[model samples]
Structures are given as structure tokens and as C-alpha cells.
Target: MTGKLRCAVVGTGHLGRWHADKYAALPDCELVGVVDVDQEAGRAVADKHNVPLYDDHLAIIGEVDAVSIAAPTSLHYRIARDFLSAGVHVLVEKPITTTLAEADELIELAARHGARLQVGHLERFNAALMDLDLQNQPPRFIECHRLAPFKPRATDVSVVLDLMIHDIDIILSLVDETPERIDAKGVPVLTGDTDIANARLQFPGGCVANVTASRVSMKMERKMRLFLPNGYVSVDFQNRVLTRHQPGEREMFPGIPEIVSEESVFEDGDALMAEIRDFVACIREGRRPLVDGQAGRRALATAIQISEQLSA
Candidate 1:
């Protein structure tokens, strides 16, 4: 806890490579090694960062203080459990595990071992969202749409888990309440699982969130709008833009209230680095992560509920 923490990145694919890069760049941590089943891909990232590469995580598990698990969804639970059992802090990508039971087990394991478990809800670190003033005013109504052209990489899971879960995690964080009711519908398009899906969640305090996600869109779009008591806010996640609208004193027409709008753009912020830095800081300071295992579990549970409803 005094000197630099030794960290490793498991699974050096498209996203995992970035994790390795960030760790290498941070002065507070040392990039110990990289793990990937694909030797060529793993070696490429390891060589780029000047780190060692390993095919299996267990070989280097005890050598590192912490690890970033970017493996496939199915392997998340097992890999995370192994590291947590070894008393190593972990930062795993979203949808903590394939099932709620697995997520619960990991959470318990992390707690029993006194190791930090941070979920990679990357959007929680989005610069646009971080710039917004979302403190006192909770959103009463929320709408989210995440669309992307078909990609075979993440087709192993449904759109609900792959895409909608991001919005779900954000919404759950804002609402701070479990959904009382969930209604959903979806269909499989390109993959065996649901390619496009929609879900309406009703929270305990009359807050409602309507979410839609698709991997079969012509254009990519990631946006979320929130209707608060005093004003409205819209965020373009892809562009890192935030726009807010509130009632003005004067009206354009008699007896009508005019609207005032303001916009903020963040073009040069690195959310991934911020997220990883926070994980490292939490480990050093003994603080909880912004998005912990329980939060990820809640989002995954809700997503699974919606997926079940879609099937039913």
C-alpha cells in the first residue's frame, strides 16, 4: 500500500488492450503482465506496453496486487472468483456475471477475502455525465436509446445485456430504487440471441425509465434524456455533449413561459483512464468504487428480468 501497485490486464482484446495501456501509463501502478488465450493478440499488446504475456491468469495471479478482467461474459465469474479468493482486488467489465447467483457469489467472495471488486460501468465515468449537475434533482422520467450497426464481437449476449445494461446501470444509480415493474419486448435479428430490445421500468417512487437498445442500426447513437422537476437534461454519450433546458422568466408569447437552454461539450477527456485511476485510488485509500459489485448485480438482475419478459 506504500509504493506502486502491481496491476495486470486479463484478455488483451480490443477493450482489454486499452486497460493494459492505461495501467502502463499510470505512475501509481505498474503494468505487471497481460493475459489472453490468443497468444498473438496478447503478445502484440504486451510487446506494445513492454510487459510479459501469459495464456492463463493463474500463472501470474499471485504476482499482481490487482487485475482488470476483460474476458468474455461467460468466464467473468470464474476468473474474478479465483482472483478474489487470492485476496487480489479486481475491476471486471459490466454485467458482473452471466447470472445473478454468480454475481452474488463473487460479491460474497470479495467481501470474505477483503478485496475490492469494482464493476466496469464505464459510462459512470463519462465526461458529459460527470459534468452534469445531477445532485439534488433526481430524474422522474428517463429515456435512453443505444443503437449500433451489427458487430459479431459482442453478439454472444443479447442486446439487453450488451447494450441496454449500460443505460440500466446509469438509471439504477440515479433512481436509487429497485424497479417495481418491468415490461419488455425484443426479437432476434442477426444472432441467436436478441439483437434489438426495449424495456420499460417502473421504480418505487413513481420514476419511470424507458430503454431501447439495438445492434442492427444503420447509424450509431448513444443518448439519454432525463426529465427532472425543475428542468430537462439530454446527454449525447457518443459526442460527449450535454444540453440542459429550464424555464425562463419571460415568455415568447403572452401568458406562456419561455425556455432557456445551455450546452456543454467535453472533447478531450479520457473516461477510461479516469475510471482506472479511481480503481487504483480506491485500492490505495480503502474506499469503495463508484460502481461496485452490488450496483452491477442490480443492473444485471434488472436486465435478466427484462430478457425473461421478452422471451415470455
Candidate 2:
């Protein structure tokens, strides 16, 4: 509500560094500080960005208007809970919390404190997905594949939460409905937890989404295909490309599968920056975030359901 939105980046590790950098670059945002459990990591990022660094995240909570929590998934509930309780708006990474109860608490806390709680479902901001017209063409069937080479960093959780949850968030947003049933299965390969997983979600509208996520893949691929009555859409998350194929338009080609394709290409842009900027703007304008706590909870709940089914 003042000259600039002073924001802090908590947990200055891999993703946190990107958050700090984006806040530093935004003219409307003031990078008040960076915090991490690892003091060296925090100080190094702050030094690079020329901002104050804190070893304890709470030290900067009162110093900034908002925060981006990029800490470990386990710490999300505590950190986000404390920040929101203190009336500091938060932009938390995906899988808002490890459990549905924790996610619910944060949602209520944000509302009670009158603070914004934004979830980092970054794919919603992807240019390709942004352009697709989801008017009356909600998919009856959705297929998603999110595969990546083993990275020791995010293996704390299963591939369902780490990777598949992204697609789950997108699908939930697109379907605009609640799931009626879910059946899932997975096996742990590289890690003690599930390294590859798949889920079939059944919604009330007869919509089904078949989602698969793997962290033990040979190469990386993030793609989704939506099948509708009149046309189909394919999105490549890695390349930010969208291809659409629709039915024939001309009378001469009536009843024929006349193919029309347009590749929606977006310039290689910084998604992290876009996410942070949107958070800062929300803080300044007091507007609800595009990915609010309820939105996050929807995705997290679906993921938990799938993970439970896998365990069974």
C-alpha cells in the first residue's frame, strides 16, 4: 500500500535464489531480504543481490510485506502458517503442505488474517496454457506425462507430489469440478518413495484425467493432451509450446478431418520472475492471487488421494 511492495524470499536454496533474483529485478518490488536455514546459502544470495540476509526466516517476517516460501516441503506448513498469522502475504511453492489438514489450516489462517496465500502452481502462467480457450470445451479425458531425470534435491517426496501435482493443479483448474473417485498405482524405483506414479481421477462431470509423473526417466518431458469433441490440444511444458487441431471449416471438406494447426510459441521468458511479479502485484493491489490457497488445496488433495491409492 506504499511506495513499493517490500518482499522477502525465504529459503534461499535452488528455487529460492530465483525468487530473490526476480524480486530484486522488479521495479515495483523491493527485495527486503533473503532467508534460509543454511546461513551461508542465504548470505551468498543476499550478497549477490545486494540485500540483507537472515539465518532465521522469522527475523525478516516483520521487515517485509510479503514473502516467497521456497523452503523444503516439510517446512512449508510451519513457515507459511507463521507468515500468514503475522499478516504477511505468502507465495508458497507447490504442494502447499504435506497433509490436507495443514493445507486447510493455512487457508483458514490466510482468510482470518486478511492476508493473501498464493500457491506456486507456475504452469497456470505458462503462455501456452494461458492461450487455450477453455470456454465450453472442458475435456472429458485428459492425459498428462511429466518425466524428469533423477534429481536428489526433490526426492524427499514421491514423484506424484513433486511432478504430477503440477498437472493435477492445471487439470483441476480446467475441469472446474470436484473428483468423485480416484484409482492409482505406483512403484518406487530410484528412491525409497515412489519414483514413478500414475493416477486416474474421475470427476462428477464424467471427466477423467490420466496422470503420470516420473523422476527416474532417462530424459525430461512435460506434456499434456486434452481430448474434446471438436478438437484436441497438446502442450509441451518444457518448450512452452501449444498445438491445436480442430475440425474442418469449409463446406467442401464437410465431414472430413480437415487439419488446422497453430503452434502457440512464447518467447523464452522467465516463469519464476513472472510468478514473483504477480505475487508482488497482489500485495500492492490487495487482489486475490491467481493460485489461491483453495486452488492449491484442490491439487494437494488430489495428489494425496493418489498417493494413498498407490500405497494400498
Candidate 3:
């Protein structure tokens, strides 16, 4: 809380290694250590960053002021709970935990210890999404598609949790309302869990979102389209492009109104760094994070509901 905040990255796998690198490069943070169940993997990252390596998170929990948890979804609750109970701030990856009850417990534990709990809803930091001018324009209809080729790394959870949850969080944030009902369907292709799924969410205010995610696709695509009362907006997450369509003053024909289209493209931005910086800033400033425990809980709750419908 004084000079520079000490931080550690737990579960130094594919994503956790980058978390360690970012913390090491940040000026306001000190990369204290890295933890991983795989000792070789952890040691490799630590050596590259010149930080200490630990086999277990418990060994480094007392050494850091904050921790980034990129562990497996099943271990999220236990790992995050231990750190938060120790009064250390946490920035855990998305879907906070496997169950709603676990998420609720983590939120309560963070508050009890006065520790900040942030969720890694990475897309919320997307440059294209961040640039959208959707302040007053509430979307009436939202459509999302996140497709990717099969990868064996995250097969422990269904595609809904692994991929669709990103769009779910974004839709939930934009609507700011709990969904009244959910209809979902899914099929398992390459894993025991659902590899491709679709969900329809209806909010109280008549806003609806149709989300689809597939891990067995041939190509990768990450896109979302929002239909607002005054216009339509499209965001391409992979390419960092935003396109807007609205009515123009001029008429195209006798009775038809002209439509104006504008497109904005952005460079591949560093969303993870921004997310980590925000977490550190919140901890230092005593402010709430953009994606806090409650928001994470909401997204998880909705995702669970969809998953249940899929199973039924």
C-alpha cells in the first residue's frame, strides 16, 4: 500500500506466463513470484522474468499484495478464496467459479477481508468495444458469434463457459438487467462437454441477446452486432474494428431514407496489460474494478442458467 505493490501470478500456463510478464514490466508493480503445479513451466517463466518460482500458490500468498489467478476453472474457487481471505487483492479469470454459490462466497469473502476482487472479463477491455458510443443507446437486439478451431487445453468446461461467457458478460453489462428467461441448445462434438452451444436471453426491458460459441469450428471468428433504436453497431473483436450504421438526413429515393455507414479500425491493442493496470490502479486508489465480483457473478449466473437449459 506504500511504495510499489507486490504481485504474483499463479498457474503459469499459457495465460499465466503473460500475466507474470506484464506485472514484471509495470512500473507500479513488483513481480514477486510465479506459481504453477508444473514446476518446470513455472521455473521457465520465472527465470525468463527473473522472479522467484513456487510450486504452490500457498507458498507465495503471503509475499504478494495482489495475485492474478489463471488457474483451471475447477481450482478457481479454492485458490481465490485462500488469497482473498488472506487480505490480498485478486484478479481471477472469467466465469469466476464453476458454480454460483462459489462466486457468491468469493464476493462475500473479498468484502469481509476488504480485499478487491476483479474478474478477468478480457473483452471488456477490447479497444473496439471501449470506443463504442453506446452510453444512452440501449440495444434492443444483440447477436454474438465466437468460433474457434478445437483446442484441447480448455476442454474441462463447456464451450459456453470457455468462450460464450465473454459475450454474455458484455451483453449483461450493456443491458444492466437480469434476464427473465433463457432458451438454449447445444451438442457435444469432440469432448464430453458441449463443444458448440447457443443461447437466447430475454431481459425484462425487452432487450434480447442471441449468443453462439463453437470450439470445433474450422476457422476463428469473434463478432457481435447490436441493434439500437437509433442505429446499428457491429464490433469485430479479432480485428479490432467497429462499424456503425445510422439514418442520414438525405433521402436515397422518393420515400426511402438514406443510411450512412462509418467504420473504425484499431491496431491490435494490449488488452491484458490494460486490464492488469486497471486492477493495480483500483487496489492503490481504493476504487471498485470495472469487472468486480458482482458483475462476474451475474455473468456466471446467466451462463449457468443457459448451461442448465442446454442439459435439459
Q: lDDT of each structure?
A: 0.93, 0.88, 0.94
Window of ten residues with lowest summed lDDT in model 3: 53-62
lDDT of 2 by residue, 129-205 (tens): 87788559879899999999999997789888899999999999999888899889899998889999888889999
Off by over 4 Å in 2: 250-254
How well does candidate 1 match the true structure, expressed as C-alpha RMSD? Answer: 0.9
The sequence of per-residue lDDT tens digits that candidate 3 reaches over residues 147-208 is 99999887889999999999999999999999999999999999999999999999999998
Q: What residue pairs clash in candidate 1, if any at all?
A: none
Question: Which rank order by lDDT, best down to worst?
Answer: 3, 1, 2
Residue 43 Cα positional deviation in candidate 2, in Å, after optimal superposition: 2.3
Go through the candidates in order and give the C-alpha RMSD of each one to the true structure. 0.9, 1.6, 0.9
* Candidate 1 TM-score to native: 0.98
Quote the positional error of residue 194 for candidate 3 in Å.
0.3
TM for every model, in the order presented, reads 0.98, 0.96, 0.98
